[model samples]
Target chain A: MEGEIRVGIGTDADLVIARAEGRAMAQRLGFRRPDPTLIATAISELARNLVMHVGHGEIIMRPIVEDRRSGVLVIVRDEGPGIADVGAALRLGHASRGGLGLGLPGARRLMDEFEIDSQPGKGTTVTMRKWRLRDDLERLREKRQQRG
Target chain B: MSVAILRKGEYFIASIQSDLSDTEVLALRDDLIERVGRFRALGIVVDVSALDVIDSFAARALRSIALAAKLRGARTVIVGIQPDVAVAIVQFRLNLDPLRTALDLDEALALLELRPERKPADGR
Candidate 1:
C-alpha cells in the first residue's frame, strides 16, 4: 500500500516498462490472472497515449483499500496539450491522429473506475482502479451456492 | 529487439516473445513485409499468445502489418489472443477485422494450408 511504482513514459520502450510494472503490481495485490492482464493492458494504453500525444508522462501504480474491497489504482499524468472536448474524445472511432482511436475509451472500459481531468494547453491526468478481492469472493460464493 | 521470423515451407511465422514497444511493432511490420517478399511466403501467422497486454498502438500496428502483407500477396492470421485481451479489444472497438484470426498457431496453420488459393498451381 505504501510502495507505489512510478514509471516514466517518454518513448515506446517506456510503455512496455509501464505495462510490466502494472501487471506485476496487480499480481502482488492478489489480483487474478485476467485482472492483472486487464490492468496491464490499461496501463499500456495510457502510456502509449502519453508517448503519442504529450511525448512524455508518468504512470503511478498503487494499491487501494475501500471498506472490504481491495484494488489497484493507476494514475497517468502528462503535460501535453489537453483534450478540448472530452466527450468527443471518448467516442468510438474519434481519432485526431492515425492510431486506432480507442486508447482512452478502451482503457475506460477495462478498469472498474475511470476519471480524467484536462485543460486545453495545460495537461491531462487519468485515474483508473480495478477492485478484485470483493469480486473474487463474490464469485466464490456464487460457485459454492450453485454446488449446493 | 529483433522479432523472429521463421520460415515454415511457404509460410512465415512470427511469434511475439515479449511486450513490444511502438518502434518494435513498426519494425516487425517492416520485417514481415520484407520477409514475405524474400521468402515468397503465401501466408503469415503471427503468434501473440505470449503478450499479456496489447494496447491500441500495437493493435493498430498489427492491423497495418496484416494489410501490408496482404498487398504483398500473403495472407495474415493473428493467433492466440488471450480472453482478457479479446474482451478489451471488443470493448474498445479496436477494428482488427481486416486481419484473420485463429485460436492458436496450429489452427492458423491449418486454415492457411486449407485455403484453395494458397495451394500451388500444380495442386500440391
Candidate 2:
C-alpha cells in the first residue's frame, strides 16, 4: 500500500502543520516513536527553509515498500534561489542567512538516505528516505538463518 | 499559544504543551524575558515534555530565552527532552551545551533548589 500527503509552506504556522502531518504520516506508515519524531524534525527544517528562503514551498510525504522493506519518503521542493554550493550547504554549522545552520545537514543525518538536486537560478528538491529498522533487522535475521 | 508561564515561589515555570511555530517561539522569548523582569524570578524551568519535534529555529529560540533570563538574574533549566529529540539535536550538530538541562521537571526543580544563593558578582 502507498499513501501520500502534501503540505504547503508559507508561514511559521505552516511549519508546525507540516511537522505534525509528517509525524502522523510516518506513524501511520508503521514507523516507531523516535522515527516519527525524526521525520517530523526533518520536515520542520525543510519547511522553515522554504519560508525563510523561498517565501513558499511544498512538502510531500509518502510511504513505500520495496522487496521486503518498508519506509517513508519525503520530498521537499522550493522555487527559491538554489544553493550555490551543495557541498558547503551540507556541511554542519554553515548558515547562509542567520540561524543554527543545521537545516540541510541536520535533515540529512536524521534520515536513512538523502539526496538533493539544485540549480543556481531555478530551485531545489530534497529527497530523503527512512527505512523501517525492524524490517531491516528481520531481513538480516532471515539472511542469517538461510546461511545457516 | 496554550503555553503558560506560572510563578512558583522564586521560580517561574513555562510548560509547553503543544508544538510551537517560529513566530510563537519568538513570542515566547519576549514573554519570558518580560516575566523574568516583572516577577523578579530567580529560576526558570522550561518544560518541553510534550514537544515531539523541535527544529533549529525553536532550539535557537529556547537558547536565546535562556540567555535573556540569565541576564535578568534568573537561572534557566530545560527539562523533558525526549531521547529521540536528543539524538536528532546531536546529529544536527546543534549546540545546546550552554543551557542547563535536566531529565524532568522534578530534577530541574531539585537542581535549582540546590544552587547556592546568587552571588552579586556572578555576572553571566
Candidate 3:
C-alpha cells in the first residue's frame, strides 16, 4: 500500500478527518499502541496550523518502507503568507497569531523525522515521518513461514 | 452537538460523545463556563475519553474552561483520558498545570465532592 491519502484542510472539521486518517494509516502500516496516537496528534497539530494560519491546506499521508524499518510519512502544505522565521516558529511559546504556538514544535517532537520548507510571501511545507523497526525474531519467523 | 451536559446536584457533567473539532471544543468550553454561572454550579466535570487525540488547541481549550470555571467559584475536573492519548500528550510536554484529571466518571465526581476536614475530639 504505497498509495498516498490526501485530505484537504480548510475548517475545524477537516482537522478531525485529517487526524483520523493519519491514525488509521499508521495503524494499517502496523504501528503499535502510542505510535498511532502520536501520529494522530502530530497530524492534528500540523493541520490546525493550516486552518488557523493559512485558512486552507492539504495533508498527505503514505506508508513507507526502508530496509527493515517501516513507517508513515506525512506532508502538510499551505499557500498562505509563509513563516518569516522558521526558528522562532519552532520555538515553543512563540505565538505568531495569538495561538499557543505548540503546533510545529509539538509535531516535530511526536514524529521521528521532521523538516520544514517555507519562503516568505510564498508558502510552507512540512514533511514528517515516524518509523518502526522490525525485530529480528519477527523477521526470521516471517521468512521461515514464507519458505514453508 | 455530540457533547452531553447534565446537571448532577451542584456540578455540571459534560460528557463528550466523540472526536470534536476545534469549534466544537470551544463551544463545549463556552457552554460549561456559562452553565456554571447560570446554574451557580460548584464544580464541572468534563469527560474526554471519547477523544482520541487531545492536541495543543484542545488541551488549551480545556485549560481555559477550567480557569474560567475557577474564576466563577467552581472547580473543573477532566476524566477518562485513554492510555494511548495520555502517552501522546505526555510526549508533547504540554503544560497542563492546574487542570485536575481523574480516571473515570466516578473518580471525577468524587474529586469534585466537598470533603470537610475532620476535627479531633477534645476531652474536657
> Of the candidates shown, which would achieve the greatest lDDT relative to the real structure?
3
Write model 2 residue lDDT over A42-85, tens digit each, in one string. Answer: 88998888888888989998888765778988999988889899
The lDDT-based order of candidates, best leading, equals 3, 2, 1
Model 2 sits at an interface RMSD, in angstroms, of 1.1
Share of native interface contacts present in candidate 3: 0.85
TM-score of each candidate's B chain against the true B chain? 0.89, 0.90, 0.91
* TM-scores, all models, native as reference: 0.87, 0.90, 0.92
Lowest lDDT 10-residue stretch of candidate 3 chain A: A134-143
Per-residue CA lDDT of model 3 for B28-105, tens digit only, reads 998989899999999999999999999999899999999999899899999989999988888998878789999988
Candidate 1: segments with Cα more than 4 A from true spot: A135-148, B116-124
Model with the higher DockQ, candidate 1 or 2: 2
What TM-score does chain A of model 3 get? 0.91
Superposing every Cα of model 3 onto the true structure, what RMSD results? 4.4
Number of the top TM-score candidate: 3
> lDDT tens digits, residues A1-148, model 3?
4589999999999999999999998888889999999999999999989998999999999888765888988999999989999999999989988588888898899999999999888899999999999878867876898799
Error of 1 at A142 (Å): 23
Residue A38 deviation, candidate 1, in Å? Answer: 1.1
